[model samples]
Structure formats: C-alpha cells, structure tokens
Target: MTTRDTVHELLRRIGESDPEGVAELFAEQSDWRFSWPDEGHPSVPWIRPRASRADVAEHFGALGAHHAPERNRTTVTRILVDGDDAVVLGTIAQTVKINDVSYTSPFALHLTVEGGLITRYHIYEDSLTVARALSGDTGPDRRVP
Candidate 1:
C-alpha cells in the first residue's frame, strides 16, 4: 500500500478504537513520539515514547484506561500528504474518567509511512490543557489564554 493509504488505514483503526488493528499497520521498530514538557505535567499514561508496534497497541490500550471512550472524539479537519509523510490536522476531545474533567484541543499528527507500514508517528497538542484536566484542575483560571 502507498503512504497515503497507510495513513488513512491508521485513522480508520483509531476511529474504531481498535488498538491491535492499529499496531498491525506500524513497522516493527517505529517511532511514536509526542511533544510535551514532562517537568510539572501529570504522568499521562499514554504520553510516553514508543518504539515497537507492541508499544503502539499498549499506548492505545492505556489511553482507553485513562479516558472515557464514549466521551472521546477526534475530527480530522485537514490533511496534507507528500511522499512518505502525512500531516493530519484535527481536534481531539477526551474526558478523564477519574476526574470527570474534559479537555478539547487542536491536534496535529505527523506520520511517515514506509514499505506499507507506518515508520514515524508524532503528535502535537496542548499539553497544559491535557495535564490540567488529567490532574483534576477545574478551577476558573484553568482556561488557557
């Protein structure tokens, strides 16, 4: 399959919340990276570096553990594909089950496909918003400027 096809399949698997299916589309030793400053941030279980396809499945599994799947929503607003790379711009909203606090933020996924499998997956999102929600910080001042 082509790079674009692989990315679309990944999106489909994510929409289905099929963690195992998602892992099957990734290369053996792929890069699943996230951009978040970990200093004061709450340890989001699914926000760690992932190297293997198994870790990819675990990431999704852990994500389901922390958030309410029924309340999770992702909308792809734009997509740009070039050769082996695809950039997906979208919005993701998820509610932390423990705190019942929800965070909705814009997200960008940078993905690279090679040999019919995904080799790179990097996501950029509002870390502070997610951190605050994860920590149960629902103060009036929690709104990010």
Candidate 2:
C-alpha cells in the first residue's frame, strides 16, 4: 500500500480501538513524540515521549486506561501527503472514563513512512484540555468562553 493508504488504514485501526492493528503500521524502532509537557500532568502519563513499537503500545494502553476509546471519535479535516511524509489535521473527542467527562481537541499529526512502515510519528494536541479531563477536573474554569 502507498504511504497515504497506510496512514488512512492506521487511522481506521485507531478509531476501531485496535492497538495491535495500529502497532502493525509502525517500524520496530519507530519514534513517537507527543508535543506536550513531560511533567505536571501525571494524570496524562502518555503525554511523554515514546520510542520503539513497545512504547507506542504502552502509550495506547495508557490512553485506554484513562479514556473510552470505543466512544472516542477522530475527525480528520485534512490530510497532506508528499513522498514518505504525511500530515493529518483532525479533531478528537473522547470521554474520560473516570469522571465521564468529555473533551474535544484539535490535533495535528506528522507521520513518516519508510519501507512500508511508519518510522516517525509526532502528535500535537490540546494538552490542557486533556490534562483536565484525565484529572477529572471538568469545571467551568477549564472551559474558555
């Protein structure tokens, strides 16, 4: 499959809450980086940097532990692909299992595919909203009017 097709498939697997399916798309030593603070948000432990396919699986595991992936929805607004690189702009809506609070955040994901496997993955999202949701602090103060 082409890089674009592979990325689309990866998104499909993620939306299906299939971590193993997503892991299949990545290289054995892929680099995954989440553009969020490494400290102060212990509730969202998966926000830290991840290297290797195992780390990727652990990141997804942490996400499943904190949120209901079956109920999560990701709407890809745009996808730009060139050569082995692809950029996906999307919005993710998820419900925190702990407090049943929902949060929607815009996100940008950059992916690099090499030899039919994803080698680099970088994600940018609304970390504050995620942190609040995972921490069970869905107060009015967390929302911007």
Candidate 3:
C-alpha cells in the first residue's frame, strides 16, 4: 500500500480503538513525538517522545488508561502527501475519564512511511486544552485574548 493508504488505515485502526492494529503499521524502531511543551501546565506523563513499537504501544496504553476511548474521536479534515511523507489535519474530541470533562482540539500530524511501515510520527495539538482536561480544570470562564 502507498504511504497515504497506510496512514488512512492507521486512522481507521485508531477509530476502531485497536492499538495492536495501529502498531502493525509502524516500523519496529519508529520515532513518535507529540509536540507538547514540558511547562505551562502539569506535563501529561504519557505525552513524551517515544521510540520503538513497544513505546508506541505503551503510549496508547497510557491514553487508554486515562481517557474514555469510546468517547474520543478524531476527524480528519485534510491530507497532503508527497512521496513517503504525509500530513493530516484534523480535530480531536475526547472525554477525560476522571471527571468526564470533554475537550476538543485541532491537530496536525506528520507521518513518514518507508518500506510500507511508518517510521516517523509527529503530532501538534492544543496542549492547553488537553492539559486542562487531564487536570480536571474547567478552564477560564472566558476565552483568553
């Protein structure tokens, strides 16, 4: 399958809440990075840089432990592909397990597929919203300027 096809399949697996299926799309030593800063709010323990398929599986495991997977969805709005690299723009809506608080954030993901396996995965999302949701904060009553 092409890189784009592989990415779409990965998304499908994620939607199905199949961590093992998702891991099958990546290389054994793939690099995964979630670009959330370490400060501003309490760091999400599971949102750190990871390498290897096992690390990726553990990352998803942590997310599963903290969030209600059935109440979470990622909607892809656009996809751009060039050779083995692809970028996906989407939005994620999730409910925190602890407080049942809901959070939505726009996200952009960059993926590199080689030899029919994903080698690099990087994601950019609204960390503040995620932090608030994870911390059980209701956020400010009004939007920040």
**In order, what lDDT does every prediction score?**
0.85, 0.83, 0.82
How many pairs of residues collide in model 2?
A: 0
Per residue, candidate 2 scores C-alpha lDDT tens digits across 27-102 of: 9998777767656478887777677787777777777788887777769999999999999998989988988888
Q: Candidate 3 — what's its lDDT?
A: 0.82
Predicted candidate 1 versus true structure: per-residue lDDT over 28-50, tens digit per residue = 99977787854335457678667
Clash totals in order: 0, 0, 0
Residue 18 miss distance in model 1 (angstroms): 0.9
**Local error of candidate 2 at 97, Å?**
0.5
lDDT of 2 at 93: 90
Candidates sorted by lDDT, best first: 1, 2, 3
RMSD of 1: 1.8
**On a 0 to 100 scale, what is the lDDT of residue 103 in model 1?**
84
